[model samples]
Target: MKNFNIRSLMIFILFFSLKISAQNSYINQYKTIATELSQEFGIPTVVILSIAYMETGGGTSSACKVLNNHFGMTGRNNVNSSRFKNFTDSKASYRAFCEWVSKRKFYEKLKGSQDHNDWFVAIASSGYSTKPVEWKQKLNLVMKKIGL
Candidate 1:
């Protein structure tokens, strides 16, 4: 019993450390992407991350698995409509999202304006209509929670 307890304790500690490390990696990734997106699109990094988190559960969801897409991107890119895969790797998805925003093409055309407050609603409207209102609220709430 004593040996078992010690082994369990060590295992718990190892898992705890791994969890913290994973979180740190995620934060670092978000920070890097946010910096790039902020520079390119003039949107707040936290807001961008909030959108990503909501769309792909911070890179743990299946939509991200098949889509390589973080922003709930629809349809295809570079491939025929039929051949297009649904997933984009986490990093690539974020990069693609940022590029789409920065260029004012594709997804950019979907937005009515660049106004911060209007963003959530605009995106929410674009196919996100069903979840638009809730996502907007959540996105705004996340921005507040993160001090963004």
Candidate 2:
């Protein structure tokens, strides 16, 4: 029993380490684009990164893979449709996200703000997610996990 417990613990540790490593790699891959968007759009970098990470599942979501829609953004006149906005590339997707956010009414108020809570609240209130509360909760978890 003791040996089994030790092996299980080792396996768990290995899995956790791998998850963290993958997350770090994902962040590194997109951090530059996120940073640039934040600077240009006045959105917090952490907010942008956390939302992208959660929405795309670290860029593994079908929307990200197929549509290059990193933020789960739906196409115009297709909000109720399954179709998402297709981008030329991941950077284009990121830029589109920033453009969408910049148009939000709360953008001017929360612009350049580092407060994730406020940003999440504003975003959720803006109909960004069908399940706003749950979405914010998950975003919080992603932000925490990413150490942002």
Candidate 3:
């Protein structure tokens, strides 16, 4: 029993540490862009980062890598019929994501909302995703995982 308990503890610690490391790596990579966007757009930094993390699959998805679309945005760079917008770089992708939000009139009401909950509602109600409740729940979980 003692040996079994020790092994279980070790495994638990290993998984816990890995999860923390992965979360930290994600923050290190994307926090800057999220912070900048938050400051510019009045959206909470945590909200932006959480949403991006959920959408882009921790910034490792092919959609984000190849299309530069962190927000899963669909549409051409200039053509409406295009399926997704592609950017030259991640920075452009971030900018485009912010721009897309800014263009929405409903987003104007979201400006200056400090509460992450409100941001979640704004995102869902704005038709940002087909599964609004699930989307909000996932984003909230990401926020918690990131220590936001």
**Candidate 1 or 2, higher TM-score?**
2
Tell me model 2's lDDT, rounded to 2 decimals.
0.89
**Could you tell me how far off, in angstroms, the CA of residue 12 lies in candidate 3 after the best superposition?**
3.1
The sequence of per-residue lDDT tens digits that candidate 1 reaches over residues 77-143 is 6534543335435667777766656554334543334455566665566554477777788888755
Global CA lDDT computed for model 1? 0.64
Q: Each model's TM-score, in the order given?
A: 0.58, 0.89, 0.82
Candidate 2 residue pairs in clash (backbone atoms < 3 Å):
42-112
Model 2 misplaced stretches (Cα beyond 4 Å)? 1-3, 76-82
Candidate 2, 63: how far from true, in Å?
A: 1.2
Query: Candidate 1 versus the native: TM-score?
Result: 0.58
Q: Top TM-score: which candidate number?
A: 2
For lDDT, the strongest prediction is 2
Question: Deviation in angstroms for 47 in model 3?
Answer: 1.5
List ranges where model 3 is wrong by over 4 Å: 1-5, 76-83
